[model samples]
Target: MADVTQLIHDYLRHNKKFPHVFCAGCGHGIVLGSLIRSVHALGLPKDDVVLVAGIGCSGRMAVYVDFNTVHTTHGRALTFATGIKMANPRLKVICVMGDGDAMSIGGNHLIHAARRNIGVTALILNNQIYGMTGGQCSSATPQGDISMTTPFGSLEKAFDIVDMCKAAGASYVARGTSFHAIQLDRLISSAIMHPGFSVVEVFSPCPTQYGRKNKFRNAVDMYKWLKSNTVKVETLKDPTQKPDDGRIPIGVFRDVEEPGLEERYFELQRKLMGQNR
Candidate 1:
């Protein structure tokens, strides 16, 4: 196998930004690494790819990657990515968002983007809690979980991002964890290759905040918990067979061909122009 460090360096933006800002034991770095590997595996030109990120730990990912990047405001990465893809459909656009950034504040934008079936890939790093702005409860925070804002435990139910995307009309939807680095890479690569709106919800661990407050002991404990609590989609061949243990279902939940918004828009424009002449 190739040196993993060298492979990561191939897609990173070296310089003063050499070091990242993620806390120790944070799984965002692992997700970032998988993203880089996915881009590399596709052999996409750095100049042809555009990475847009929102405010949060996952938002900082665009700044570290060697690509045409845009750091947008919180909960607006998808909006910007949508405009980018619509304006120039040839460019590969990817949006990086945290659980709160994507599902809470930007939830409307996310669903609309999926509903439109735009040619943009959304990568949501779901660490359960809002790690960047302290350990606050987010939309994806599991019920009964403790957080800075949820001292009495979170009461709201968690959002199943994968199901939401699939229901919202995303052409491709997949879920993976930081522990499954290789599978995460493959999922991301597949998302990028998909023509319409695609979503990859990565279950990253927030060791410092979420872990410390939730009695996770350490990052390893969190990883083990993730592995044990998630069941591969292939294992549950029968649609009626649900995981009796309440484990989150992981793997590609949806992948199908669809006419993307960009393509349809351009085709309509071409027809209008021809008719006018």
Candidate 2:
């Protein structure tokens, strides 16, 4: 196994895109690291991969990854990814979206993409608040959480990303935190290998913005909260076990084989061509 430094050096565009814009304790870097390791573990050719990201702190991931990358407009990463996948079905399309990007402006696109079951992997880095846009309360922000836009308290309920994806017909849906780096890598690799639409919701922490407002002492405290509050999906299945005190569930919620949209579309085209002939 290669060392962490070597793995980063080999997979990241460090020479050109070094000195990332993420805050010192932001968890986006950990999520990105897991993504790179997952790609490496799956033996994917970098040339065959296309990374798309929307406008946000998470969007910076496309810049650092050494792949065919696109920084799309805010909330448009999924739209661009869907087009890229349809145009070149051979390419592996991966989208990185922030909580606000995925659940607010891009919510419709996220659901429709999953409904079509396109072979694209969406990684929603859910930091709760809109970290890039001045830490405003986003759709994923938990109830009662304070933010710039919700100084009194966020009254809106949070969206369950994994549940939303599963309900949207995503073939693969999973949730993980930045703290679980190794497990996250495995989950991401599995999602990439899945043949249909996949959604991986990564609970990343924004120490500088969201953390400061939410009364978290620091990044370490935020991570500790995540570690203590998250329970695996499998564990929750037992009737004896119940998640309490605002514990969130994490792990692969769904994974099943299905023909992706690209495959079905090509099949339809073949049939139409035969009819024409």
Candidate 3:
């Protein structure tokens, strides 16, 4: 029985199978660190952890992790992860996806997954642009943002990921950024420890794509902006108050327990079997 902190270190040192494909200041690294730490804290067996990822930069996490990772089709990580968790019921399913992968091509799956309230954790790396797909705007990208598809500026509004998940019945929802490493880890660990569906939207940076277009010099500059522009909800409790022009909200926006899909389904099954008994 190693100490929790020691266990985290051990896992990081010993789990050497995952390949690294993330950019230099990619938030995926921070998210992964937090996730691995959470798993360590939970003392979940590596073999019992199933990480499903979609086709994107963040999706590459599946290949780098030591768990039973599945690199599924584009925007299908949640669908596959749902199946895996429902079938096994014992495995801890964690879905890792990029904003475009989760909120666009996989939007239907994401909505239903949240509505189902499956006992799983979904980590969304929201870099605002489709990093792997040549820097196109994603559903999570802010309005007026510029991408390859929207050279001048984007016309469509962005989806508030936390609100969307909350509306769809996610038990726990949180938003964090690459700059808030410790807080991000805490939120992620809390999500994994939760018994119902949890989503941690991580604000990542696409330096090469988004940065260049947005006039950010590099990943570090982006990180600095993230740290300064992030607003914790508690700090903005005034009724008339709102985030600044360029600021974004970040924190454990919502967390509440609910009857997870598996639990409810099993209860119904038990009742059906009881009639025969």
**Model 3 backbone overlap count:** 2
Question: Compared with the true structure, what per-residue lDDT tens digits does model 3 show for residues 68-116?
Answer: 9899999999989989988998898999999999999999999899998
User: In candidate 1, which residue pairs clash?
Assistant: none
TM-score of 3: 0.91
lDDT of 1 by residue, 1-277 (tens): 5677798898888873657899878899999888888888899999989999999999988888889999999999999999999898999999999999999999999999999999999999999988888889999998999999999999999998987898899999999999888889899999999999999999999999899889999999999999889888878866435578788788888899997899999999999999999
96-142: candidate 2 lDDT, tens digit per residue: 99999999999999999999999999999999988887899999999
Model 1 spans with C-alpha error above 4 angstroms? 239-241
The prediction achieving the highest TM-score against the true structure is 1
The parts of candidate 2 lying over 4 Å away from their true place are 238-242
Candidate 1, residue 51: Cα displacement in angstroms equals: 0.5
* Location of the lowest summed lDDT over 10 successive residues in candidate 3: 10-19
All candidates' TM-scores? 0.97, 0.96, 0.91
What does each candidate score in C-alpha RMSD?
A: 1.2, 1.7, 2.8
